[model samples]
Target: MDLQLKDLKGIGPQMLHILRNNGIWKPYDLLLNIPKSYEDFSITSIEKWHHKETITCLGHITSELKLIRGYKKDRVHFQAKIYNHTIDIIVFGRNYLIKEFKKNDCVLIKGTYDLYKNSIVASTISRQDKQIEIKPHYRIEGIHDLKLTHIMKDLFESQTLPIYENLPKELLDERKLMSRREAFYQLHLPQTFEAIDEAKRRLKYEEAFFMHLNMKKDEKIETRAPKPYDIHQVRALIEKIPYTLTLDQKEAVNDIFRDFKKPFTFERLIQGDVGSGKTMVALLAAYAIVTAKEQVAVMAPTELLARQHYQYFKTYLKDVNIALLTRKTKDKDMMKHMIFSHQYDIVIGTHALIEEDVLFKQLGLVVIDEQHKFGVSTREKLIEKGKHKDVLYLTATPIPRTLAMLTYGYAKISLMKEKPKRREAILTKYITKQTIDDMYSMMHSALIRKEHIFLVVPAITSDKVTDNIETVYQEIIQEFPHAPIFMLHGKLSSDDQDRMMENFITTPGSILLSTTMIEVGIDIPTATLIGIYAAENFGLAQLHQLRGRVGRGNLASFCYLISTKEDVERLDMLVQSDDGFKLAEFDLIERGPGDFIGHLQSGYLDFKYLDILEDEEIFLTAKEDLEKIMNQPDFNSNPKYRYLYKTYTKQT
Candidate 1:
C-alpha cells in the first residue's frame, strides 16, 4: 500500500504476478534485477542507421502514417514511413499505435533502423511528451519494460524514494562500490553503459553476500548444544560389513566419526556420484553410530528407495533390530510398538521418518538419501529432530566443482569413482522410428537369453507429459503381444507400484514400463535391456541414473535411447561421456540458468543468471564478499551496505 516495488501507481494484478515470479516485488527487488546487457541506440543520423546498424533512435515522427491490410492477419501491418527514408516502415503488432496515429497530430518513435528494408521499426513508440521516459526491456519478458518504466518514472517524481544514504558512506569509499540510489537509478534508467556495469557489480556482490550469510546463519543455528557419541561403536559395526569401503568413503566415514565423537552437533553433506556406493558409505556411518547404543534415522526420496534401504538393513544386520517406517506398512500398531519399545536399533523410511510422532530414543545420526528432494525447511526440520546429533546427507546428483566449494563449504566431501567389479558398461545406442524393428529384434535376443527388461516412460498416470506411458504401453503391447508388461508412475498407489516392481523383478519374461521413478533403488540383475523413449527429453544426470539401473547386473546390459535422429545427436553428447561430474558440467553449461540447478543436484543453490560455469569468478567473488560481511558485521552495518542488506534480506 505504501508504494511498494511493483505497487507502482499503474501496475495491475497480472503484471504484479509476473514481477513476483521474476523475483521482483519490492523496489529493491527491481533495483537488484539488473539488465544483462544494454541496447545502444544513441545514433542520430539516417546515413549511420542505413548501414544496417541495429541501434536505438529517438525522434519525433512526421504526421504521415499508413495502415495497410494485407492478405493475412499477420501480414496486415502498420506502415509509418520515417521523414527521411524512402522505404516504408513496418510496425508489427501495433494496432493501438495505428489508431493513436490517426487521432494524434504529434508523434515520436524510438527503434532500431534496418537498412536492408530502408526503414526504422519502432522498439517503442510514444507521444512526444512521453518520449524521454526510460524503459527496462528484457530478452525473455516484455512485460518488465512497461512495469519498470512506469515504476521508475513515478519514483523519480515521488517523495517516497528510498534512503540511499542510510548505510555508512565510508564503506562505499573503502569497497570502491557505488551509492545505493545510484545503483538503482543506473540499473533502471542508465545514462551510460558504465553506470549499468557498476550496478551489476554491486547487485551481484550483494546477492552472493546474502547467500553466504544465510548459509553461515543456518550453520551456526545447527551447531548449537554440541552432542557427542562414541565413534568406535559405529566403527565396529561397519567393520563387520562384507565389502571393503573405498578410500574416499573410508576417509569420509573416519572424518564423520571424529565429528560424531565431538560434543557439538555435526551437519555435513556426503557428495558422491551415481553408483558411487553412497548407500554403503551411509550404512557405515549409521552403523558406527548405531553400535554406540544410539538410534539413527535414514530418510530416502521415494518409497522404492526407502524399501530398498530397509531390505539392505534387514538383510545385513539381521541380528540388530531394524524398524521400517513408511506410509506403506499395513500394520500401524506394529510400527508404533517397534518404535516405542526401542526394538529398532535403526529406523529407515521416507518422509514418514520425519513425522512428529516418530520419536527417536537417541537419534545419534540422521542420514538423508537424495538430499535435494527435500526443501531447505524440510531438511532443517529433520536436523532439528536429530538434536545434538550428526547429519549425513547423501546425493547422487554430481555437484559442480566451484559450487561444491561455495554451497557445501561447511561439509566434507567423499568421492565414489570406482564401479563394482564385473560391472559391465551398458552399451548405449540411439534408434529412430525407422530402426524400431531392429531395436525390437535386439530386445527379443536379450529375452531369449533369459534376461529381464525395463521400458521407461517419461510421464506419470495423471500428470500430462509430452508423451504418455499409456500410449507407449499400448505400442509395446501391440508390437510384442506375447511379452508381459508392468506399469509404474507417480499417480499409482504405493502398494500398486511396489507390487508391479516386484512382479517385474521376479517374472523373467516380463518388461517393466515406468517413469524415472524406477531409476533409483531398484536392482534387477537380469534386467539386461533398458529403453527410454524421447531420450533427449531428460537431463543428463537422470539419463545416467536410468542407464545405471540396468547395468547393475553382470550380464552385458544395453540402454536403447529411442528417439528421432536429431534427438539421438543431442543425446550422443551425454552417451559418450560416462563421467557424471563431466556430464554434470556439460549439462550445466548447456542448459544455463533457466533450469533449476538444485532440483537436479539434490539441493544445490540456483542463482538467477549467475551460472556457476560461465560466472565462476563472479560466484567466488560473491562468496568472498559474503564471508567478509559475516566476519565483519560492523562493516556491513554501514550505510553503503544498508541497501544491499535490505534488498537481499527482503527477498530471502
Candidate 2:
C-alpha cells in the first residue's frame, strides 16, 4: 500500500508538512517511524516516587489548576491527590494544562518526580478514561506525544501498511525470525519486552541483509586483461632508492605487483598509518605502470597534496615525464595537450583531473590519495576515464581489520603498519587551558633547539577575536616577542598557501598558525612541536594524522592537545595509544560507523537498524547467507531476493 499521507484521516496539510520534514511522507515511512523510547504506564503510587524517576500515577485534581507567570516563563500548578498522598503537579511553559484540568478531575500524570520541590513535572496529563499498557514516544516535532501515538494507532488499525517482504521464507524459518508484518506490528505495539526484542532482531537482520546485497551488487569482478608491468625495471628502481623499505612496505609492493599480473583489472586498498611511507609504495606502482608505456594518474584531495605528489614523483622518477593539473595551473592548455598527446607519462592533480577537458592517453593506473575524501561516484567517474584500469586507494587513516573486511570485502587489502626506521613516535600530551604557561615553555624550548612549531586552530577567524588563528598568532608573537608567525587556511589562495608552507619549511623556529588544511600533506621535517587548539573537536583519526606531521624527522617531536572541555575521554584515547589501528577501533566504538568512516562511504551501507560494531553477529550472519545465495543456482529466480535487490537499487 503506497498510500500518501493525504489519504490518511486526521492528517492535515500542516501535519503532512511536519511528517515530511521528519522523513515520513508515505504509509511505509509511517510504519518505519519506530518509537525512540517506550514508557511503562503501569500506574504507581506517589508514596513510592523517587527523585528524577519517570513514573505514571492516577490521581484526582484536588485544587484548581492555576496559570502563574514565573520569573522566566508561565507555569501551571495544581495539587493532585493520589492514594493517600497529595503531590504538586508542575507544568512549565505549558499554560494550556490549566484550562484542560478542573477541580476533582480524574487524570493520569506521566512525568519525573522532583523530590526537592515536592512536585511532579508533568510531561503529559490525560483523562484517566482508558488503560494504557506501554506508551511509545516519537520524536516528531510540532506534535504532541499523545497525538502521535493516536495517529500510529489509527494507522495500525487501518491495516494500510505496505506488505512488501524482502526476505525469503526459508531463511526466515531457518533463523526463526518474525514475519515482516508481525515484526512491524510488534515493534510499535509490543505487548511484552520479548516481542520488542524479537522484532528488533528481525528488523536488524533485514537491514543487514539488504546492505550486504547492495554492496554485493555494486561489486564488479573485472574480466578484461590488464596491461602487464615490467618486473625488472620496477625492481631496478626499488634497488636504487636511498632508504631501505620496511617489511610491510615491501610486502605491499609485492601484493600490488602480484595483483597487476592477474588477468583482470586490479582493485586494491592500501591502508597505512601516518608517516608510513605510503607515497613511496604508490610511486613504485606508478613506475611499474609507466615503464609499461601506460600513463598513470594520481589524484589527491587537495591541490597542495597533488603538488607534493607531483614533486615527489619527479624527484624519484627522473626519467619519467610528469605533469601537474590543478584549478590554479595557469598552463592548463599546455598540460591538457601533453596529457592528450601522451607526452606526460604520469599526471598528478586534484579532482580537476576528472574534468571534461582532461583526457588520458592510455591511462592504466589510478592512485587516489586520501581516498576517503572522494565519494564512490567521484572515484567511478575517474575510473571511467580509462577502460578497466587498475585502481589503488591510499589512506593514512588506518581502518580496523574487521571493519575493512566487512566494508571492502570485494577488494584486495594491503596494510603498511610500520613507520620508517628514522621516524620517531610523537610524544603526545593532554593540556587544559590553565596549562598554557607550560605549553609556552615547551614551545620556547623547542624553538631554542631550532625547531619550527605548528599551532593548529579549529578556525581561521573568530568574531570574538579569541581561540582562532589570529588570536593564537598574536599570543605566540607576544610570548616570543621575536618569533616569525605565518598563517594558512582553506580561504587562502593556492599560491599564498604554497608560499606560506614553503616559508614555514625553509625558516627555522617559525610558527605556522593554520587550520586542518595542514592535516594531511604539508611535510615540514623541522616542525617538532604542534599545538592543537580545541583538540577535542577533532576525531581520533584526524588527531593522529595531525600529530603525524610533527614526528616525521629524527628529532624528537611533541604534540600538545589543548582542550577546554572537561569530557576529554575521546581525546584521552589518543594520548594513551600511538597505534592508529587501535585508535580507529576505539573511534569506531565511540562514534558509530557512519561518523567513523565519514558520510560518503557510510552512505553505501545505509543501514537503518544494524550497526557494524554492535550488530557484528547479524552482519556476519547476513554475509554468510549472502554468500550462500550468490552461489545458489536459482538466486536470480528467487522473488524475495529480487525484491530486496530492486528495493536497494531503487533507493540508491
Against the reference, the lDDT scores of all candidates come to 0.68, 0.84
Alpha carbon deviation, residue 387, candidate 2 (Å):
1.6
Give lDDT: candidate 2, residue 142. 94
- The all-Cα superposition gives candidate 1 an RMSD in Å to the true structure of 6.9
Candidate 2 lDDT over 395-475, as tens digits, reads 888886547755555567899989888887788889987998888998888888889899899888877435788777777
Clashes (candidate 2): 0
User: lDDT winner among the candidates?
Assistant: 2
Error of 2 at 603 (Å): 4.4
The 10-residue segment with the lowest total lDDT in model 1: 73-82
**What C-alpha lDDT, on a 0 to 100 scale, does residue 183 get in candidate 2?**
91
Q: How well does candidate 2 match the true structure in TM-score terms? A: 0.76
